[model samples]
Target: MSFNPFSLAGRRILVTGASSGIGRQIAISCADMGAAVVITGRDPTRLDDTLGQLVGDGHTAVPADLLETGAIDRVVAASGALNGVVLAAGIAKMVPFRMISQAHLDTVLGLNVHVPLLLIKSLLAKRSLQQGASIVFVGAVASEVGPVATAVYSASKAALLGAARTLALEVAKHKMRANVLSPGYVRTPLLDALGNTGAKIDALLDITPLGMGEPVDVAHAAVFLLSDASRWVTRSLFIADGGLTTRMSV
Candidate 1:
């Protein structure tokens, strides 16, 4: 008997932060796997660009900023029931600890931590997540690496890791799964925005044996977590960092 556990046919998924970068790639990859994808982002134009790139039909674009209190509710309400949910929307900045401000902390934590948590809450309230559905929270290697100038970013991602683990236990009764996907350095606009120039990337290559990863690299790992292939997987943090952690640990 032939079997392919990764097929997402007939699955309906909601992917947040799908306007660009990792989230955009994840949305495209999920659609490639035959899932009906609903992608959300604050920029309607970028979301439309992503929606246009998706392979299959029945995909939707809902523009909403997760930082807003009621925005998530509207997203879930429009999505209907979902077989998977990928919380890939996040904010990152390289600000020195000495320069960290209250506003900075609030903005980082609000979007990275509170938004995803509240979004999940909204989904649950609306019964938008089907039984056996999978949840994927996109964390970052900064949480584990403790890099310089990423105090709040690391904390926010660490909070997500902790929350996803707890959510896994709490949602067991619903036959749902939750996990975190932590990636090292990926080539995205966000990375460029973080001031990672070619020189910086060359420096990073020294520590990361496989060099910088692509958005699709992280997206593939997310696909596994969101697909039936990971039916028995939950409360796990899947690191797709191309051996950065391994090298750093040595």
Candidate 2:
């Protein structure tokens, strides 16, 4: 008998956006901690790549486009009863307030807020979740800070913060936990795709006292929320931002 409170052994967990970046790292980390993980992403090839990199067996890849019709049911059907659910499938498009359009708002909010919350509803309908199961919504520091050209992205993430808090109260009677994870300037593939260079990088580094973070940093925090170590925790917003929000004003 050992005292590893963060061990995820004997648990079955599902993680969305597992093809790359933070989602991929979370899936791998969960398997490393001894959990059977079910990974889902829009791209089959990339999802398989992530599945192969997992540290343990019983980790399955279920490629899915959550925005597509009936996709939620298919994902739920493909996954088994779970101890944890990580909703990390989201997109961030930085658009200025003046240029924000309905389509842009719909696209960002649909995946970031709608898809994950809808999937949770489907999981509940099918009773696929285990008692004391934990549900984590991947949010961002944009929810609290005002970043230029990030109006839509900020709204999407802010919605998750409120959703998780309310979801915790609604699901508590079933002994399930709901929480949100907010990361600031994590160096992921997505960040790279957003063109992380020059002024943008320098600006982020200047605000983040500890500089930018990596996927592993956020993954470890996810492990804690998904593990029994945080059984008593729910409805809280856990921020892993390298002190980005701790800057002092002169």
Candidate 3:
């Protein structure tokens, strides 16, 4: 019995933030599942590195600053029609309430919220989305669980969840699906930037009963959401945080 429900053969997927971390993993995973993927990031070198790692044919690298909202339409035009999109590009910053400024809010929200929303609008406007298209937004457990000095980041993520829900409803008539993949502390460059502040790492681990998650852990979930296997699964938030949110009080 050959089970091929997860096969993405003939599908064209565009993955943002594909240069590194979870986005990189998702691009590789999607390619492995037989999708022709377009990997996008600001770093051309890193995007090329990811493109090289893709397992199958038709994978391409597209370097674009997603922060440039106007460029989103060009990105869609370059990639052609998209069957799926993984909006994985984002930034995380830790700033206390007193230290938070308009710049901080704009940077965080621009990347996390504004970019994804505008990208979707551009993609839809191009009429490039095929029926049954899936759009997966990478969210964070921080949206629901509180962490010190992550108010801005958390708010941005929370906004994604809300936006995805509404977008799901609006796009359903077009036979397109939208959802959020929220992950906990996965081993990524963002986490590495946090550094080992003595007990901070240990404290986080203690709260997460299943320990730290790897990039592939979230990547696999992304694959499921992108593939036809999850055709009925839209307007939902799939939490892949290894039970971290369940253990935490926030």
Relative to the true structure, how large is the alpha-carbon lDDT of every model?
0.91, 0.90, 0.89
lDDT of 3 by residue, 1-250 (tens): 5878788888999999999999999999999989999989989998899999999898888899988755786688888888999999999888887899999999999999999999899888888888889999999998998678889999999999889999999999988999999998888987887654221655777778789999999999999999989999998999998887886755
In model 1, what lDDT does residue 80 have?
88
TM-score of 1: 0.96
- In candidate 2, stretches whose alpha carbon ends up further than 4 angstroms from where it belongs are 196-199, 248-250
lDDT of 1 by residue, 47-160 (tens): 999999999799999999988777877898889889999999999877889999999999999999999999898888878899999999999988998877889999999998
Task: Please give, for residues 128-240, the per-residue lDDT of candidate 2 as tens digits.
Answer: 99889999999988888867888888889999988899989988998899999998888887887665432275677787888989999999999999998999999999999
The candidate, 1 or 3, that scores higher on lDDT is 1
Candidate 2 has a TM-score of: 0.96
Counting clashing residue pairs in each candidate, in order, gives 0, 0, 0
Model 1, which residues run further than 4 Å from truth?
Answer: 196-199
After superposition on all CA atoms, how large is the RMSD of candidate 1?
1.6
Candidates sorted on lDDT, descending: 1, 2, 3
